[model samples]
Target: MSATTDASRGKLIIPVLGRLYSSLHDAGETVLRVVAGAFLTIHGSQKISNPFGAAEMVEGLGFYPGALWSLVLACTEFFGGIFIAIGLLTRPAAFAGLFVLLVTVWFHWVTMSQGFSGAEKSLLWAAILLFFVIRGGNRHSVDARIGKAF
Candidate 1:
């Protein structure tokens, strides 16, 4: 049998809960997307205010033209997060966020030699952005309302 059938049939021990879950599946995804974007936005807010404050840090991470990269990172996290949260140009925004997160992953894992323990949060954020990069947004998004996605 198909996975959906298996889930809706044999696998569900509580039929009522299963039915509720089925109905709210899209809602769950929306919640995840919004929360992820919001958290990213919050994380960048201070950096965005300072703009080039991360220049030295990014240079330490081996990003040349530290000022430029720092500005890019700030804008991507701030503006990109807003875009992703509203599902406007979600894929592109998520792609940008994913790029920044990958850098953080490298910084935490390899640069700091902290391994997966330190890189865990960046890795998780990267995965979530990757999902938005692949899936764009769902029906509840502005992309859906405007009938456009990029």
Candidate 2:
């Protein structure tokens, strides 16, 4: 039988599992949001003090107009992360974060040739952002309060 079902009775087991899942659902999302947002915020804040600081490195990577891309990365990492941490415009923020993480994953794995060792952290962060993009901020989020989300 499926884990969600009782084999002997052939019935859905609603009480125990359902209650447990509901109990942890919001709390789990909150934890993911806080951790991801906090780290992204720190990384982004560092970039904000000098938005174009990465221009040389990015240009070296062949992302021409490096200054523009650098600023975009800085804003996406900082403001988007803050919006996510506060549970405001969460999906959009997560989407942006995930996009950035994907690029980092490629950079670490392919560009830097650091293999999984370098890419692992970014890959994990990408997974976290992917979850938020799909699941969205929970009921505790401002999106719920405002009654809209992207």
Question: What is the clash count for each candidate, in the order shown?
Answer: 0, 0
Q: Which ranges of candidate 2 are over 4 A from the true structure? A: 1-18
Error of 2 at 92 (Å): 1.5
| Candidate 2: residue 53 Cα off by (Å) | 0.6
Report the C-alpha displacement of residue 36, candidate 1, in angstroms: 0.7
Model 1 Cα shift for residue 133 (angstroms): 1.2
lDDT of 2: 0.86
| Local distance difference test, candidate 1 | 0.90
For residues 14-86, write the lDDT of model 1, one tens digit per residue.
7667666767788999999999889889998989999999999999988889999999999999989888888
Cα lDDT listed for each candidate:
0.90, 0.86
Q: Which stretches of candidate 1 lie over 4 Å from their true place?
A: 1-9
